[model samples]
Target: MSAVTELSIVLQHDIDEQYQYQPGEIIRGTIYVTLAKPTAIREITVKVYSEGNVSWKGPDEQVYQAQEVYVDSSKAIVDTTYDIEPLQLPQGRHDFPMDYILPENVPSSYIGKYGNVTYTMKATVVGANSRDTAISSEPFLVLRRQHIPVLAQQPLSMTASRRMLCSCSFGKLDIRVTLDRGGGVPGEDVFLQAELKNQSGHTVTAMQASLIMTTVFRAQSRSTEFRQVVSKKRDEMDVSRGEGRRWTHVRLPLPPYVPESKLEFCDIIELDYVFQFRVEMTGGSEVRLEAPFWVGAQPQGLEVPNNEQAGRRIHKGWTVRGSQALLFPDGGPGDGENGAGDSGGQQPHVEHDYDEGWGITLVPELRNASEVVTNPLYQHQQNHVTKGARDIPEELLENTKL
Candidate 1:
C-alpha cells in the first residue's frame, strides 16, 4: 500500500495570479496529506528554500554556476519517536499550517537564459520501513523594490573622439551624446540627443543608440559579467569634411518586465543598465560612447489624472451652450433683464442690505461750491493754481468776474 495517497500545498493569497512576496514578508500556507491505510511514518517535514543556477558556454567548455540559498527553512510536522506522545498513523486527511518569514535582504526573483533565481516549498513524508519518501513541491516568486539613486535624478552626457590616419592623411571624428534624465521606469522612453562632427576625410556611415543590460555573476571566487543589447535604434547619415549632424531626440523604449538596478540583497548577482552610442566611419574606427543609468520602481502617488473625464465635462458644457443658443435664438430663459419680460412687467432687481456695522463703508460725493469747500486738499490746490499762472491772469479774472 502507498504510504501517502495525496500531498498538496496551498498559499494564503495569490500575487498577480502567482504566489509573489517581497523581503520581510511572511509567507503563510498549508500542507495537506492523505493516507490510503494506517501506516507508520518516520517524519513529515516541510521545507522552504531558494536557489540560483547559472550555466554558460565558455570558449572551450560549458561552465556551471550556483548561488547560496537566499532563504531556507525546515519544520517537522510529525516525528514518530521524537514526539512527547507516540504518533499514530491515520487513514484520513491531515492538514498542517506552515509559516515562514523571508529575510530582509534578498534578491528579486529572476529567470535568465544562463541562470535563474527561484524559491520553492516542499513537503516530504518518510515511511518507517521503506527508504522511499513521498514528496510534493511548489514554486513562488519574489520581487524586490528598487530605490532610485541620486545619480539617476540628473542628466547624463558624454563625448567621444576617434582619429584615423591613411596614406599620410589624418582625420578626426567627435561625437557628443546626452540624455534628458539618467533614469526611467519601465514602459517609458529615454530620449537621446546627440551631435556628430566629422572633420575626417572619410564620410560618416551610421549612428546608433542602444539600451544595454549587464548582469554580473560571482561564483567560486571568480566574477563574470555579461552584456546584452536589449533595445537599439539607429540613423544613417553622410557627413563630408567639416560637416556636422545632430539628432534632436531619439527614443529608446524600456521593457516593463526587466528587473531594476543592482539586485542588492543577492550577494552573488547584480544587474545594471547603460545607454550606448556608436558612430561609424567609412574607413576609420567607430567612435563609441556609453553612459550608465538606472531603472527603478515607479514612485507611489504619482498617478496621472484622468483627462478623459475632464474632456467630457468641457465638451458637455460647450454642447449645453450651443443647445441653449439654438433653442432661444435671441436669449435663453435665465438671460432676461432683472427677471422681467420686455412687455412692461414690473420686476425690481432684488438687493440685499446688511446691517451698518457689518463691515460696510459709505463715500460722499461733492457737487456744488458749498460741498467742494469741505475738501481741504481741494482748497489748498485752488490757492496754488493762481501762483503758477501768468501775472495778468488774476487781474483779468477779477475784472471779468466783477
Candidate 2:
C-alpha cells in the first residue's frame, strides 16, 4: 500500500469586493495548491462543502438537530491533478489553479455558530500504484454578519411620523381673494385683489401660477365644471416664506358674449383655479396646487347662511353670453391625475369672455336639489377666501420695509 501525500492551499482576493455586493452576488476566488512532494496520483478533484444547523430539545430532554443543511460538489475541478506518469512538475514545487462557484443559497456563518456558513475546498488524489487516498480540507468564511447584541438592545421609535396617518400631515394652506364689485358693471371693468399665503413650512416653487375663477355645479346625480381666467398668473414669488404671504392685483373687462337666456340657478357654484409648482432645483419634480372657491344664490328671497359671504352675481340671461367666449388652451389644464387635480374624466372647463379681453368672470348656477356638495365647497373654500388673510392686513404690509 502507498502512503497519503500532504497538500497545501491558499486563497486570495482583492478589497474592492465589499460595500458593493448585492444579495445574489457571486463570490469568486482562486484555490492555489502546492504539493508536498512528488507522488503517484491519479487525479485531483475539488469539492466545496457546507452545513447549517438549528437546535431543539428531544422528548428525552436532550438537545437534538432541528435543521441540517448541506451544499456539496457546489464547485469542482473535473480532471485537474498531478498524475505521476503525465507531464509532472519538479519534485520540489507543484501548483494548480482551482476554483469553486459559490452557491446562491449559502448562509453567512462566523466564529463558532453553525447558522453561519463556511466554504472549504478539498483536493483528493488517488494513489497510482496503491489503494490509499489523500485529502486536505481548508476552512473559509462566507460573509460576516452584523453583531447581534446591538440589534437586540436598540429601542423602538415613537415619533409622530411613526403614528398611523401622521405622514399625511402636510397641513392646509389658505388663499384669499377679493373681487371688488364697485367698478364692475353690465359691460365694464372688474378688479380682483388676491393674496397667496404659504401655510405649510415647506417652500413652494411653482412652474406656472394662475388666478382663475371657475363655475362648478355638483349634485347627487351629476356635476359640471367651468373656469374664467382672471389674469396671466405666474409664480413670480421665488420663495413664499413659510407662513408668509404675497399679493396680486388684476383688472378684467367683461363683454356680453353669452346671452342672458342661458343662465340658471343651481345648488352650488364653484370657482376654482390651479397653481402648478415644481422643484426649481431639480426641474423634474413638480406639484400643482388648486385654489377653488364659490358663491351661491339665495333663490331671489332666501336668506344667505350665517357662515356665507356675498361673492358675485349676474342675471340669469348672461350665462350663455359668458359661455360663448370661453377660451381654453390645449394641454392647458394638464393631463392624467398628476397633471392637475383628480383625473376622473371630462376635461376641466375654463370660463372666459372676449368682450375686450382685459379680464374674465366666472358665473355659475347652483343645482337647487343637489346634496353631494363636498365639505370643501362650503367650509374650506369659504375660510380660504374670506378670513385667511385677516391676520396679515394691508396696513401691516404697507408699514413693513422690504
Candidate 3:
C-alpha cells in the first residue's frame, strides 16, 4: 500500500514576492500543500508572530543576547480527525487561504548587525502519529509610517559665539548654521548654509559640517549609546579679524540604508540624528553650532531609487562592474576574468571602489582615514554629542565652547 511520502507548503501574497506593507494593512495570502499519497491528519494550524533579536559580543569575550516577541497569534484550519471511513480520502494537493491585519502602532521591520525586527507566518500539519508533524515558515517586511511634525517642516537655524583670552589678548568668534528643512528622508539631499565671522584676534583655520547618528540600546537595566558619522563636508578657509566666510549651498547626501528616527516599535532601543557645524580658530576657542533634524522613511509615491542607484548617484567615483566583468579585491582591472562572469542573463553584479574617495564611505576604517577630524578642543568638552526628539538641553547649549 502506498503511504504519504512527501509534503510541502507554499505562501502566496497579493504583492507577489515583495512582501512589504505599511501599518494597519491587511496581509492576505494563500498556503498550498502537496501530498504524495493518501494521509491521515489530526489538524492543520497556522501562526503569525513578530520577533526582535539582539546579540552582541563584549570586549571580555562574553556573549549577550536580548530577544522579545511583540505579537503572536495562531489558528486551526482543520482541527477534526480524518480517521472515519467517509471522511478519509486520498490526498494529492490542498489549498488554504489566510489573512491578518497588522496593528497600527507596530514598529518598522529592520535588519542590522546586532539586532533585527522580523515578522513571520508558519503553517503546521499534525498527523495522527505524534512524530509525523510537518511545518514551514515565511518572513515578510513591514515599513513604519513616517510623518513629519508640522514644526519640523520649517527651516532650522542656530547661532553661537565664543570668546577666548590668551596672553592678555581676547578675541570673539561668531558662527551660525541653517538648513532648508528640519526633516528629511533617505536618498534626499540636505542643503546647509553656514556663516563664520572671526571678530577675535585669532585667525580662522577651517570649517566643517557633518550628519551624525546616535543609537541607544537598553538591555536588562544596562543602557549603552553609540555614535556614527553618516556624512560630512568640509571647507578650508583663512579668515583674519573682521573677515567672514559663508557657505551658501553645501549638500549632504543621505544614504538609503539609514533607518528612521525613534524606532518606537522596539521599546528597548531608540535612535536620533543631528547636523553639526564648527569653525576652527587659531590660538583661540572654536565656535560650534548644531541643528537637530529627523531622518525618516520616504513617503509612498516619492520614487526614491534603490540602494544600487542611490550609491551611484551619491558617489561620482564609484565604478560598478557588470556581472560578466572580472573583479579582484586587491588586483586591478587588467586581471583576466575568472570564468565566473557569466551570470546567464541574471541580475548584473555591481562593485564599488571606495578607494576613489568621492562620496561618503560607510566603512568605518575608510571613513576614519578620509573624513576630517573633529577638533581636539571640541572633543574634550563633551564625552558624546547627541540630539534626540526632545528639546535641546540648556547645559548642552551653554557648553558650545571648544
Leading candidate by TM-score: 1
Q: Is candidate 1 or candidate 3 better by lDDT?
A: 1
Ranking by TM-score: 1, 3, 2
lDDT tens string, model 2, 1-402? 334434555554433222211112222344333444455556656666665433334356655432334456532333434433633433444555543334434444322211222456566655454454666776655431111222212221111111111136564334444444321111333344544444444444542334344444433333445555543434433443344344434444432111111112112222333322222212333334443222111112222222111122221111211333222352222233422333554554443332321133322222221332221111212335655555432221211112
After superposition, the stretches of candidate 3 with alpha carbons farther than 4 Å from their true spots are: 1-20, 36-42, 54-67, 81-95, 111-114, 127-133, 162-174, 196-208, 231-246, 255-259, 278-288, 296-402
- Give the per-residue lDDT digits (tens) of candidate 3, residues 1-402: 223344344443433443355555445566666566666667777777898877767777676678778768676666766455222436676776555556656777766656778888888877666665678787877766576566766788988878867558887777888888887766567777777777777878888888888777666565567777888887776888877887776787776556678887787667788888877777655666776778766443333223332232122211222234333342323235422233332333345434432122232121122333221112223446566645422211111123
Q: By the TM-score metric, which is better: model 2 or model 3?
A: 3
List ranges where model 2 is wrong by over 4 Å: 1-5, 14-37, 56-60, 74-89, 110-116, 144-402
Candidate 2: residue 149 Cα off by (Å): 19
**C-alpha lDDT values of all predictions:** 0.63, 0.35, 0.61
How well does candidate 2 score on lDDT at residue 91? 44
Comparing 1 with 2 on TM-score, the higher-scoring candidate is 1
RMSD value for candidate 2: 33.6
Candidate 1 C-alpha lDDT tens digits along 1-402:
576888888876643343346555456677888877776777878787887766665665757466667767676767675655445667888887665556657777777666778888888888775743589998887766565667786789998777867558997877788887888765566776778777777877788888898998776566678889878887786777788777776677776556678877667778999888888877765778887878864433322223321111110000101122111223322335422334543443432222222122221111121321121111122345555576321111000000
* Number of the predicted model whose lDDT against the real structure is largest: 1
